[model samples]
Target: RKGGAEMTQREFKDMPSRIARLPRDKRGFPIPKFVGAVDKKGEPDFRLVSHDHMAACVRRNLCWICGDVMGTRKAFALGPMCCINRVSSEPPSHYECAVFAAKACPFLSNPNAKRRQRDLPEAGEVAGIMIERNPGVTAIWVTRFYSLMQVSNGVLFFVGEPEGLEFYARGRAATRAEIKASIASGIPHLEEVAKRDGRGAMSELKRMRKRFDALLADRVPA
Candidate 1:
């Protein structure tokens, strides 16, 4: 089991040694835990997540990036929208691993980088609408608590109210303006969902938004 000791709270610039230890693809990006084999040769597609691995992560308390036994605190690297919904399709990863992803992963950090939607497998999608657009800011939600929720034909990580959070964009600490813009763009879509789900869901959305308000206030300036 890889003992991922807790580290200082900040986003990384160059790749850390811990991240270096992970297996890399031919292109040299660390192969995350959820990436699935594309063929019998066991070649991995970074864009594709393995459904089998996701279930295993929850059952075993494994980190989603390093594929190691996680310590007590599990961290989630998700979009700002996932933070609002408090739901993530991906399971928990190490703090450093998640930070590296948020900063280094092109899709999450580059607002302009579009997810390749063509030829995506059904297994790649989970139980929800999967707000396909990148929110342009990644929220690294660190918590000692979370729950596994079984949804239609898939699983979701019901992320607990965070012990703490850090947002990253464009390989750096995300600015308040950037976060605010991302949230502002996402809220209407979330609101529509909450309304469709009725009172209970609406109330939950409010609670999430309130927490985000507090978090956004603590944002780093550009």
Candidate 2:
């Protein structure tokens, strides 16, 4: 049988390094520091910095606009192009800042919105939607919205995040407000978001693989 100290070491090793390190912000909540000994167990303790004690530390570090935990935020090239400098109690990624800025942007504003639909799913809803829709759909992509590409059918449909409709489905009929209202009464479209994120990441991975393969082919054997 393993000794107590040995078992503790094994458990600590199994924990994620990121989680173990404990996340913190530069401006709002600084990351925890390794403090001096707490007890005589020969184990170390840490004191984490906090901002809003009312909410969870992770929640405090979430995207202010979408409430997504920073660890789980999605990346977008458009983030820097769409953002303006703003101060917040929490530290947010560039993409998160850009998203918040987009809300006020002329292109994303309510009055300036080109689409007729509204009400988008939360991140959790996006995850679930992706799992459920995976069987019925061929593939999914995350552009400005969740796109469902038909399997073996070559058709594409939008499930959530109606913003992309104006750009991708030009001249398409607008979604009815009643439908938005109906979805609002229930769960937000989480799976839809997940599908889009997953596919987008996959596409990026494929591109990376191709680049690596090309580089390998050019290498001269010694």
**Local error of candidate 2 at 222, Å?**
66
Candidate 1: clashing residue pairs, number: 0
What are the TM-scores, per candidate, against the unseen true structure? 0.85, 0.16
Q: Score candidate 2 by TM-score against the native.
A: 0.16
The lDDT for every candidate, in the order shown, is 0.80, 0.27
Cα-based lDDT at residue 85, candidate 1:
73
lDDT of 2 by residue, 1-222 (tens): 366443222122222233334443322221222222222343332222122431342334443223345554322212110111111122333242333233322223232234212232121121111212111100111133223333341222322321211110111211334222322332223323435779875565446445433432343121
Clashing pairs in 2: 121-189, 125-190, 125-191, 126-190, 126-191, 127-190, 127-191, 129-191, 130-191
* Residue 66 miss distance in model 2 (angstroms): 18
RMSD of 1: 7.3
At residue 198, candidate 1 shows an lDDT of 99
Q: How many clashes does the backbone of model 2 have?
A: 9
Steric collisions counted per model: 0, 9
Q: Name model 2 segments beyond 4 Å from true.
A: 1-72, 75-93, 115-222
